[model samples]
Target: MPDLGETYACVPSTERGRGILISGDPKSDTILYTNGRSVLMLDLNNPLNVSVYGEHAYPATVARYSPNGEWIASADASGTVRIWGARNDHVLKKEFKVLSGRIDDLQWSPDGMRIVASGDGKGKSFVRAFMWDSGTNVGEFDGHSRRVLSCAFKPTRPFRIVTCGEDFLVNFYEGPPFKFKLSHRDHSNFVNCVRFSPDGSKFISVSSDKKGIVYDGKTGEKIGELSSDDGHKGSIYAVSWSPDSKQVLTVSADKSAKVWEIENSNGKLKKTLTCPGSGGLDDMLVGCLWQNDHLVTVSLGGTISIFSASDLDKAPLQLSGHMKNVTSLVVLKSNPRFILSSSYDGLIVKWIQGIGYGGKLQRKENSQIKCLAAVEEEIVTSGFDNKIWRVSLHGDQCGDANSVDVGSQPKDLSLAILSPELALVTTDSGIVMLHGTKVVSTINVGFAVTASAIAPDGSEAIIGGQDGKLHVYSVQGDSLVEELVLEKHQGAISVIRYSPDFSMFATGDVNREAIVWDRVSREVKLKNMLYHTARINCLAWSPSSTMVATGSLDTCVIIYEIDKPASSRITIKGAHLGGVYGLAFTDDSTVVSSGEDACIRVWRLTPQ
Candidate 1:
């Protein structure tokens, strides 16, 4: 599938993309963040077992845990609110479309019965309050002329709600059917972050104009500013309250996260946490959340850092990964120790077992990669930029990449590993032959061949056409000679895979059907394996040549053992939170997969 529209638009790091959103699960040492289009649930205690929640159709902007700790409310750029069980398998219990534009922030009431979703809603309400279960509008958020950037509910009884918006005003509301109380306009510019104290006696709001003001949580009366002197030199993006409500934490573009003692009318700086990074104000802090004494901070690069009282100067632990949807995945046959993955942002990450998150593939423009073929020495890639890149593989460095013009952009590539010499490229118009980065020849099969595969010995070339016909051709010299046509599929063929042994092959179609063919006998249908309920996206062969793994749009990964074809099929339904788009086997015991969920997972098939 192509990159989704308008979801991943690029803007300045300070104004666009995902902000450093971190929500702490009151139940434990967990922190939630938006990993591209999905949410990542990270446990500070374990750190390695990162569980992901990936059901959103659009980019998720903010997520918050209900005070009761039993539910989570998340909002997307498309103004959709989803309330699902936090500990009960995350099944959606309620969904609401409260606004017309993007939702920038979400918060739940202390009773966990009410939720307030705030966003641009350019043409409609800037914010709204509703019943959590019934989606009934409980109150209106008035007095904001622009987008409401953030909202919070007072934690204690006399129920109160506070919202900060781009209008440089903070609106306070007073219950089940909340009413607008008043507006606190101390800030001179766009207000970004606002939060209520744990005790509900006080609240704080920060603005891009460097103002941090606290107010009486109950009456919406302005108490005093955080620092009476000037304000933050840079924009204050987020803030949090300590468990005891005595200290307030804030992160800002000034490249620091600090703690302030909450005095009666004013605040004093207690400690400053150091964030280590370089490049374009690399340490520019964006978002923060307090997990007990532990402070979690998010950087502009999507790196999460943990800081505590004992070691307030440093972040002892951090986790990093792709910040966009993974578009393609491939493993080098010559060196299977590392796996390479490409995302919608044109970022290519190299993942190793011991080390994590290797840097992106070095490209001048970093266009969206269309197809990738990897060998031990180099990785060949083609993308929408209409250029082919030959990258020298050296662990995660990606050494040196040479970009060459490929007249027409290629859609897919087939690496003939069995022969280890030929690489076939498929474009909309025809197919091209590449002999180690150099285009040697072209074959005009003419009918829009969408998928292609090379025979094990590199002697036969198979192409799947839009007409649902599999065209078999002999690879002689440079051009192809059509030998036969197999038509058993009723829809366009999506993927075709040649078995390692070259005895048989498999082809899957858009109609959710997969078929096994005999190469030696040239039979169109050797076996009909029909179990998936959605379109088969990609297929891979096991190292043993007996098992074929098929990834589909239905989110299932099925392994077909040719011995029994139908009965020996093992299905891993919902193998991925979203549809699987790519599959590859690193060895006989391990198969790696990545899909729309923006996650790469490994399924082990070794002995128990």
Candidate 2:
């Protein structure tokens, strides 16, 4: 096995609609957030640099750092909580089944010795508190008739607990052996979140009723509600208190995050950070956290916007990335600085180096984007919805997207390197040739088309079928004329690619075999490139056309050189946590891979 050196990684973004808890370490400049089955630790200073902990077997719901910042408590949809080391190397210390259903939120006590896990527990209690190490019961969280949504532990002495839930109630608990004290019904609708002030003097609760109510932290008594005359026009999803406990911030589905100053019992509006857009679904603010001097809020589209607490009038620095599995990746030949990626969900992001998102293509009904190709000044994308989209590459129209129905789902898309206006698409029923988003020709190749490739000169095309055959065709004006059908593969062909210089081509199949073939002779150049244990999902050819790389379902990447066709292959085991689905070479020594984990990693290869 060869050592895999990683140069950069872009982790998955927070999911939409859900109010994910963002926990910041009190002792460091790191924040913890959950996505799918992984817990991610992101550095605040360099947001792109992230460390992933992929131990959770179920969809992770919430994660929190201990007060001492030595350990982290993370929970999943299965209601299991795992305490692990706070260091980049996540070593599990202990595990406990705290609830029967999903755990929506987690909170650690000020001393870092106890935790409260709360959410919907089908037949059991909605909230539970226990010692961090021993898992011994420390308190009882009772009296909520519905699922709990949020929980908070007071940061000072005479520890107190506050929780809000779908039942429209706020429950308070007290003591080392904490017991339920009382419940406050101040909101008209479901309570969405609850948080204690840093000073432990007061707490605030926000709800679907579009109201924010303050309460005495110790006695569970109601204080005056925050002035709502000019407040949120939509449900308030999250609330965070300032470090000094004198102010609070609330984010709402109305596309706004507002900061308020607390004056005795009432809060007055101070500043507003409105989401920039047309106030659509993607602009809805879902989660927020006030850690140190940063005011962070996550949108329904999974963009994390950070603002300076002391200067809310300034435009926020937004972090944008994918929150779902990336299905396709293509670099713009006209502008290498922009890399375009499409995901399982209909998100098309144009990434610029160092910056998160240079721009984004308008989403198409939230369908799955299956394949992507760069054609001239436009981006062509095929989707699970059997539709093709064309997007502009420059100026103010960069995000505008126009679509056309292809009648059947497309499996793959390939661009003709020299012919900028030509592209080839493989569909379930047949092969479709496009001249810049316009269907030039459609050929029912008499078999199930699984993969395809087009020649750089647009003079020929190759279609791979499930029957282990490659049908070669000559491009004639607006149609494909069959040249010959080669039968060499033993399994369904999964991917096909022509070398950049058009000297040779490579094909991978479901049987995990990669074969390099001579273009002119149509003979096998390397037939024994078989090291993968699972189906090959993607393949990329080096710029010099001397080496080929293949990514497989076994979560490994193999680089095979044409010179040493038999013995000198380099292997990168576990290149992606999940199976790798997309692979591309930026140059001769750099490759980028994206996978089921929704993370895109750049690897620096030193092939010996």
Best by TM-score: 2
Model 2 poorest ten-residue lDDT run: 3-12
**Superposed Cα deviation of residue 176, candidate 1 (Å):** 6.1
TM-score, candidate 2, is: 0.94
Scored by lDDT, model 1 comes in at 0.77
lDDT tens digits by residue: candidate 1, 38-138: 76666766655566666788877778888777777888888998877777679888888978998888888888888888888876799999988899998
Q: Which candidate should be chosen as best, given lDDT against the real structure?
A: 2
Residue 260 of model 2 has an lDDT of 92
Report every candidate's CA lDDT: 0.77, 0.82
RMSD, one per candidate, in order = 4.9, 2.4
**Residue 590 displacement in candidate 2 (angstroms):** 1.2
